[model samples]
Target: MHDLIVSPFLDGFLAVRPGSPACVRLPTDLYEEVRAGADNTVPAWLVQTAADAWSLDLDGKAARSALLVREPTELAFARASWEINLYCNFGCKHCYLGERPLAGLSWDDKVKLIDIFRDSGVLWLQITGGEPTVDPDFEGAYRYAYRQGMMLTVSTNASRLWKPDLLRLFRDCPPYRVVVSMYGATEESFDELTQRKGAWKNFRKLMAAARNAALPLRVSIVVTDDNAHEVDAMKAVVQGWGLDHHVYTNMQPTFSGEGDPLLVQSTEFLRKRPVFEGCNAGVTFFHADPHAKVSICKIGRDDQIDLMTEGIDGLRRLGEISDRLMLRTGGCTGCSLSGSCRVCRPLAKVYQEAKAPLGMYCQHGDTKEMVHP
Candidate 1:
């Protein structure tokens, strides 16, 4: 397996180490030189540069086939998020995927989907789920994507992280990051929030194992009404474990426009988001559901492109779709606060459809002036 991945990133090329965050930008001429080098060998200067960046000695004459993998396309995407399956072990109240259906593409089809992702220029792929690790073909898919030179981020619940086979796989080919969601601080609150008995115990055991193995891990502190009081305790727990964490208090309506999740929102913990800025979703990134249906992003699922049928060419239409979906329409039509709106148009539409309070997503709401508690 190659330790370095040379891939087209946006308008340029990047040489990055698998399982590491370090990257080096290669100029057009250097990229062409590497691609056209004799016997697919890495140049001496690049070897020394990579050694300096990673603090590891490398063979100057290493065959490119042995030391690196290059992406085959210039029209590559910078990032993508894929929901391998919607199936999840935990039934949390604040989950945006409300239905929690047990469904996804078969192994053969999944392989095809990954190929499309690779061919379409996906460099950084986030494998998520209703809990991605629980998928039956997750290991196969993960190994395949890693081999394809795509840096991966697994968004999991940490329930299955302790499995010996999984630990070995991660040790052999580490993901760029494993994002685990922390439901609550205490076992009682944790299990109650997920509505799954023994979940807290399983999570604790797996987290310890993962830490012992030195796997790259980050924590997302999910704050809801049930665990609102334990927010501080949650932070302390993560800190004690020596893991980086981010607090997430805002709860969105379900993909189908249901407001059930909004009921669990902890108003006290809600933090104001930064000002709305333009995003590269669909232009530089995209989201894919289990069945290989591509959308602008997780939040905007309209006009999905069927990658399984239409193939990668289907993505060409997303640029147009992104523009249309971002228009200030429906409830937001003619809104005076459009310039300073925090939520994007598609997300705002979902909130409006669910009849969510303006205070939750709108700057013009009565609670817009709320301060962090």
Candidate 2:
């Protein structure tokens, strides 16, 4: 039998309420305490004793294990991201949000957003947009998220990041991390991808300044047919930074959609790569849009019930959404690749629009290989 594995989050609590099934292992003393509504504390010795009593597994090993179960909070790591707006200044060829530039968010709305996220009980918030910095009240919104104890991460072009005060603000009030998309490693390539001249210089200067400030940074590289050949080179560049990089395979062509046009690769190109066959949206993680609309993940967002209004309680309502509408249910059952399926809600949306075969719809082709490798 496969050994059991435990998640770190289970370290202290005997029970975890992740908006769904709670994992509980009853110990007589603990159960009594809980029944009495006592301020029960789980000590290390108690945990070891309980594990011994249950013979639980640890991390797929035969050692001690922590009680764990699939739940909404566990899904998506229980983190929350609010796509404040879709409008971005640079209308790149591969944007998923499909937001228009110059269409900024209102100040009153920004205040309300702070309250919404703060009240949601989610301690993580991401401010994204066409260009979040472009928001008229961008600083105010950011300060609000910070004041509320929500860790912040900004996905940006880094054009205005050169501003000293802004850099100081981020370095002093550092969030968990900031992710910047580097279209290309060089000037010509980057300019081509962003369709904005001088963008490369701006990125280079800002990244250097951020490095000086010791800001936590992550880089994402979008792989496409146009730049597929450069994957190896990009990997080298990412390695040079001594930081991990994320590479996304281009989404497949869509019949008609609001998303950017894709650089469709051939079937051979996809098959020659690694294979991932299962999806972990509702099971491992979930995605929510700007309005708190929930999707199993980005791939299925267009198809799931809105959770903002319904709250976490709405997941049960998926039972009524009909299997036919849930594409993965029909295509994924018992598939050998089920464990590694890369399909997510956003990718699923692309598939629905392109009607492309499942293999062709992922952001990066069917593999989790380190791009640099």
- Best model number under TM-score: 1
lDDT per model, in order? Answer: 0.87, 0.53
- Error at 223, model 2, angstroms: 2.3
Candidate 2 lDDT, 55-143, residue by residue in tens: 43232221212222111132223345555655566756666555364553466655665654444344445677667776666777786
Q: RMSD of each candidate?
A: 3.2, 10.9
How far off is residue 118 in model 2, in Å? 3.7
Query: Residue 142's C-alpha lDDT in candidate 2?
Result: 82
